[model samples]
Target: MITDTNHLTSLREQFAALRAQGLRARDAARKLALSEGDVMAAHAANQMHPDVAEHSLYTTMPLDSDWVNLLQGLENCGPVMALTRNDSVVHEKIGVYRNVSATGLMGLALGPEIDLRLFLSKWHAGFHVVEHTPKGEQHSLQFFDAHGRAVHKVHARPQTDLNALEALVQRHARPEARPVFMPGSPLRPPILADDRIDAPGLREAWSAMNDTHQFFTLLRKFEVDRAQSFRLMEGVHTRRTPLVSVQWLLEAAAGTGLPIMVFAGNEGCLQIHTGAVHRIEVMGPWLNVLDEGFNLHLRHDHVAESWLVTKPTVDGPVTSIELFDEQGQVIAMFFGERKPGKPELPAWRALAHQLAQGPVTVAQTEAA
Candidate 1:
């Protein structure tokens, strides 16, 4: 964190100027060569001089490091928006946080509206933020990783219980606490050579798998990267698709009125959206789903690879459209909506098949 009074002041001034130009916080921070968390931390109440008032743009109160309890408290703030995103996509759902439970550092939120898989260990710091937006006061709880990258966020909606939110903040706020952040780790090295992998054994394990949850175990057992595994089983279970496949899939689902599941996340959280998608819009490079309860903004240009993947389960074969970035990090995943013990939807299977067989015109790739 930049703690020097002179440096902090300079950062604030520059950030304010960028904000005046209508740049979002994340973009403004990046323009100043800083992470959003770094900028937020610099503006925290604890970091300010005792005689100075909070920053006019926003006020941030550091929250206690007890992530599990803080999140559980969100249950009282009904009908809030949960946001999770990676470099290529943003996933937002409006719902109440409910049934939050944690075992050690891993947690789960099983509410019908807010479904999340939480990796609490990556959650390094949190803050209760109140931004003075043009409309009015905007309240949110933002969590960040050790590298100052955001993991997840919850924003108050019109129906949210403001008193409960305020009480939760007051209970968890640590005005004197100073959160420290470290530089991000370097990029990982490329995957190992394929000759060293146990292809035959991997195939045997994949074929014998009884549940999709065991896919991670299979990867570990074979010591293969995810994309590599798919390449190895290309003809049997995986098919490489054009980048435009994602756009085509979404449009087809919307036209057919098929309910689907969309999964997108960063290292700290996995958020899922299930049901039908009605509104589909495109703006420049972004493909957006502007629905009432759910919204997805995906930067299709960032997609370096797309795959039609199939995994075996007790119920039947489940299919998904998975997208990856240039660094081989998963950008997002799509599946047909189905519950446990239920077979895969026939419409979804057909859609996946159609995606694989669809023609990839030069115009389609260029448009995407």
Candidate 2:
């Protein structure tokens, strides 16, 4: 095996060359068999100064720093884009980071334009990354977990308050030359045995669901995996939809002027977009919802299973289009936006039916 010194030297040299070729940090890190977080930390540790860092530079901070306070400080940065993603989906919302509140290891960004449910404890490494793209300079605050996967990232938009962003960077700066230490033992999520799954009780409990929130409790009670639960309820509450459902659903929503709720998440964060989507674009293997303030990028190829899911609630039948990755992990979920005490919009429910029916040509309507 190559020595540690030789490996680090090679990685550092190769990373520099890769960056020069117009590849983003995330792509370059993947090509070199390293985590993006590690590459950022390495360059940051070498700098040893915060103020000197500019666009295309890095400033590292202790992962255990006052994370809540640092995030709250971003409130002064008006009109920034809050981005969160998983292996299959990318969510972006441009708005002011406002109404930030934390309780223990959880936080919420309840801004009118930006909505997020943040898992604070998973944050293990933090960085203020400045990148110079073809358009212009990009300033962002990125957080990663112990496994070096990105938790969440906040990017300053063109109209963001630069003075406030600069102040935030200075306040949270910790110019240290120490390397990040990640613990061993990779994630190994155990699946409940097939015999152990309570097929009867699970079906009954699912049928009795009065709210979507109760679904989580049902999973905990049965100790069933998320995607497995969908399979269990196949003939009752949920049924599998074709892989093409995602693209068609978005187009149907766009044509009908129906408002929707698109939910995307990873371990550390959940980001949501609720409102009308005007543009549904499909390019190659990517399906995108490109509209004002909110954008969702989903890899259509990764949609191993798509479900037209329903749960009985007091208001009515709450429907959702849930897509899962191959490993039985949720990639993204879609629903008709609804509030408490209100039944699902008739328009949304109708469009959802089109997706579930499959192969039915829903006449793209322009509702009044």
Compare the candidates by TM-score and give the number of the best one.
Answer: 1
Clashing pairs in 2: 56-130
Tens digit per residue, CA lDDT, model 1, 224-340: 998888888888888988888888888877877788999999989999999989898999999999999899999999999889999988999999989999888899999999999
Count of steric clashes across candidates, in order: 0, 1
lDDT (CA) per prediction: 0.87, 0.79
Give a tens-digit lDDT track for model 2, residues 259-279: 899999888899988888888
The C-alpha stretches of model 2 lying farther than 4 A from their native spots are 1-13, 45-64, 132-136, 177-185, 360-368
Q: Which runs of model 1 end up more than 4 angstroms from their true locations? A: 49-55, 359-368
User: Over all chains combined, what TM-score does candidate 1 have?
Assistant: 0.94
lDDT of model 1 at residue 62? 92
What's each prediction's TM-score? 0.94, 0.89
